[model samples]
Target: MIETYVDERDYKLLERDRYTFFVLKRIMGGECKLLLSDHERLILCFTGHPFPVWIWTADDAAEEEMEKAYQLAKENKLLTGEYHFNIKYSLAEYFIRRAAEEGLELKIITNMFAYDCLEPVRPDTESDGGIHCCEMKDLEELVDFMDRFHKELSIDQKDISGYREDAEEFIRSGNMYLWKDEQGHNVASCKYAPDGDMASINLVFTRPEFRRRHYAENLVYQVTMKAKEAGYVPMLYTDADYVASNACYEKIGYVLRGKLCTIG
Candidate 1:
């Protein structure tokens, strides 16, 4: 059976499932809404505006239950428009095939790897004095870094004005940090997206001139350490095909946990 749940308390039932913890944490943080099948076996979380509907199903979830979950989303208009869907690889093929049969097109598919780290992180000894939280005065430089970061990845570029606004909010929330060299030139940056006891390290980037210097790695290590120190389990998602980044996360002590696919 499928049902919709609105109460924040419903998230407590998901605490034991680490694979779904980030989505559950987002729901608990009021960042999204939740729908469940059989109380938790099949979970669908919707974060409106640019974010996708994250679907997580138990390994033993029957095919019928998965189909029902998709049907519920369609009936509620959740699958319409330009919204995207993110699900495990084990279910992505089935979900995509089924959606096509229903005349819903999911054109772009990207494979990703999820990583999690539980042990305390050790910061690079040489990076200690160069890393620090971003301040309001650094907004313009941060925006420049973000633009270059997006361009390098071929991701759509955000309007500079809008980007500045978001960066300001991120700085005010104490979620952004940057790495600077001895001359005070910013070389790399990263940020945290926290939900409950789980926080995802995101926006990791380094200037092309600083690519091989381990600046990006150091920034991620610092952010991960901060998240762990604050009592949150640190995790991150990266493109599976991005070898350098995948290797960097592994070197930073994150272990591969699962694979996810995004369709839009």
Candidate 2:
């Protein structure tokens, strides 16, 4: 049987899977609800507001128990609408197969990678541009970048005001940075947000005209360095199909740590 509340044993299980459950560590005891199988071998952490579902299954967890836990979660309406399964790469096949058995299509979205200054990162490309924290004066340009970013990714585009608001928020957070050429033109941008002991570096983009100048690599390197200097482990998610981006991150010292699959 699956239980809704987690006990001491479950906490220990969570600790054993800390890397796979990093996001859970940052949100537990708040908006998240824990669901555990009797042996605490299979678990789910579902957050209400954000509506993300995370699943974990121990190597020894019985197949029957895993199915039971998933069914119970569905009965509780936890799997309604769209639910992406954020789980370890080792468990991806099991979930994907199970989703197929249930007539639900699931797919691997991206691989998660982490980095520490310990790895010998490739030397930053020599570029004439310098990194600078974004300010309100850069809002208009930031909005344009945001638009191109979503379009390039094929993600649903947000309205102009939504992009403007995102730009303003990034600027106010003081974590967004732009790579400005010697002539003071913004060539690339990158930003990070701290979550518990991890800082997720995202929104790394360079304008089309500046693609080959190594501006993006330089900007990401600078932003990642800032994240590390602030005492947070640096990490990011990248689409597995995006070979160039993955190659870029690897050159900067990031190592593939895990993967997430989306279930619908």
Candidate 3:
């Protein structure tokens, strides 16, 4: 049987499951709803956004349970949306097969790597001087970088005003940071979204002219370190095929926790 939970208190039930950490955090923040099966062994999060349907299931979940979960989602109209699915690779495949049988199609599939660090992240001393929190004065540059970042990833780009508002919120919250050149040109940026004891690092970006300079890596390292100092476990997700990003995160002490897949 499948059950739905919208209360924030139920998030504690998922505390020990890192695979569900991001979704649980979002749910606690009122950004999504949770659907569970078999007493939370099967988890699904629906955000009603363009991102994806985030899900996790126990390795031994019975095939019938998986079917029931999908059926539940379908009945709730969650399976009729255009959003993608972010889930364990095996489960992604299972869902794909099931969707095919239902005559539904997914547009694209990508493999991803999830990483987490419990220890202090070490930043490169050489790249430390230019790293600092973003300020309102840096809003325009930050928006430009964000737009470029989303474009590069093939994600739909938000307007400058939207990016500006987002950057402003991040700046006001003191969670956004940028690496600047000696001349004060922003070269790289990164941010962390904190949720209880866990924080997810995201929006790491470097301009084309600044590529291969270790700026993004150093910025991420700084953010991760800050998160650790604040008593939050730092985690991040990267494209499995992106070798440089994977290497950079590993160099900063992020360990691969598992594989994730997105089907759009």
Pick the TM-score winner.
3
What's the lDDT for all of these models? 0.75, 0.72, 0.74
Which parts of model 2 have CA positions greater than 4 angstroms off?
1-15, 29-39, 42-52, 76-81, 111-124, 154-166
* Structural RMSD, model 1: 3.2
Model 1 lDDT per residue over 165-240, tens place: 8899889989899998877889898999777678989889988887777788888888899898888889988888
Candidate 1, clashing residue pairs? none
Each prediction's TM-score versus the true structure: 0.82, 0.75, 0.86
| Per-residue alpha-carbon lDDT of candidate 3 for residues 1-264, written as tens digits (9 for 90 to 100) | 455653433465455456435654565456565455345566677755545666666666678767766676677676775567776656666777898888987544678887898775565645634787988888888888889998899764677887888888988989999988777778898999887778899999899997877788778888998888888989988888989789889988999887767776
